[model samples]
Target chain A: MSKLNDWVEASPERERIYAQEKLIVDTAEEIWEAMDKLEVSKAQLAASLGKSKAFVSQILTGSRNMTLRTLADIASSLGKKVCVRLLDAHESNAWQSVDAVLISRRVAGFAEVEVSNDPRWSNVIPLHKESCKAA
Target chain B: MAYSLRIAHAVENISRNLLVNLYINSSQPMDEYHSGSSLTIWLWEGAEASWAEAEVGVMEAHQAQFRARLARLAEFGRLRVPDHMNSEGDGIHAVKGNTGLRAYGWFDRVSGRRAFIISHVVLKKKQKLDPADLAKASARKDSYRLSKESK
Candidate 1:
């Protein structure tokens, strides 16, 4: 294995970061899926949200930090609302391996976990539990 | 269970088996059981959702075909791959779909399961998987094995 792979395979911290980032990326992908289902183009969505197309593109592609306000705006534009759910460890299969860290993160509150192509230093933003609490 | 976890579990099993230092993870290297044909597949971590995105219909068709293959294996004691879609010699069974989409996986019977266990799912865009993808899949299989050994 390469140095990077060896590091990732060995590092619990890196794996936790990877899992958290997967959640964010999956969430962004879900937003893209909603747009696909609604047949809304990025430009159309941007126009409706009073934002630039690039902004919408960036957020949905997981390129930019997805703010709560932004998530709600996008959802409302699509006749939806931003919904967050706390999936139990068993309920979250992809997350099961990294459950220990995620459980800590969730209890610490909802937060942004970034995944860059480089596994070295993805930023971990503090999560505000109030913003992401399940309704 | 999510398909991702299912893949993870299968890889874990394959890795543990290989760690006894007796098995190989490849298309041509592994042995098949007497009851059913075995196959190998590869899946990149975190890419499961995208499997249904582009080429939706083709993806659905391929998924349906995969289901049918599993059904046949369960009912008829055989799962045959069409020549155009299946390839050998890499130690990984490569299944090619129309529109340049491809998947890598394998089937083998495991303990506690009557049907063959389908493991390692690597989604590819080119007809041929990049060498890195193959290496990654192999490394992952080994990682899974290591995890089990430590446990």
Candidate 2:
């Protein structure tokens, strides 16, 4: 839905991809459990990556200034993966059912999220997986 | 151009309270403050989900756009605004910045200094196909791999 005046466009695919960064970072930390969640602050990530703290800070901020090599290492260190696929603008909405965000929520029972246009809203019902009870 | 936004009333006291039915915002400050006619609405105040997860390219674009807007407002010298302190039509006296749209004459909306996710915004009224408006459109956009909401 292109709004001539909205001044904002939500590429369901891109937005969905963007949403994935935080989730990946957070979950990857969980996989690091015993070592104090690694506490890999920008300082640590920088030391390990042999880059400037400021540079690491920019990367952590998800700025456009990242190199694929850096991103790959971050992904590798975090035990995650990165994939890039191009799709047309019109095809974004149809992707609703398969987006990783909604998929993860469904699997985790975090909440059932709906990404829609007409009313245009997103909702996550925090709940326990077993009983489907709100947390 | 005049700008406006629709946001949680709690935006006024975000540090003190939780917003109803929304993701936990990363505590990003709305950046600058200014004035308006009736109430003191904020600009860049609604960086919500999109901007937080926006790519760096998008943020740069927004920054460029914001700078252009500010230059225009600076030309007028004193922006007319409704004053909260005065009963008879005193507002924020100000200029506009590319990022500070809708945030006329006001102050202190940005939250949390460290670990902030940068964001640019769009008011509901001024919304358009402009990529800058959605730069930080959603906090949900910029999730680290495998990270879930507020994990």
Best by lDDT: 1
Q: What is the TM-score of chain A alone in each candidate?
A: 0.57, 0.42
lDDT (10s digit) by residue, model 1, range B1-151:
5555655766776676555324333322333222211222223343343344533655333443333333223322332324113544344444443344544443432432233322334445565567775565456455545644654
Measured against the true structure, the TM-scores of the candidates, in listed sequence, are: 0.36, 0.30
| Per-residue C-alpha lDDT of model 1 across residues A17-45, encoded as one tens digit per residue | 54444455445545655676688888999
Native contacts retained by candidate 1: 0.00
DockQ of each model against the real complex? 0.01, 0.01
Off by over 4 Å in 2: A2-5, A8-38, A62-64, A93-135, B1-60, B63-151
For model 1, the stretches where C-alpha displacement exceeds 4 angstroms are A1-9, A88-91, A94-135, B1-151
Chain B, TM-score, each prediction? 0.45, 0.22
Whole-model lDDT per candidate = 0.44, 0.32
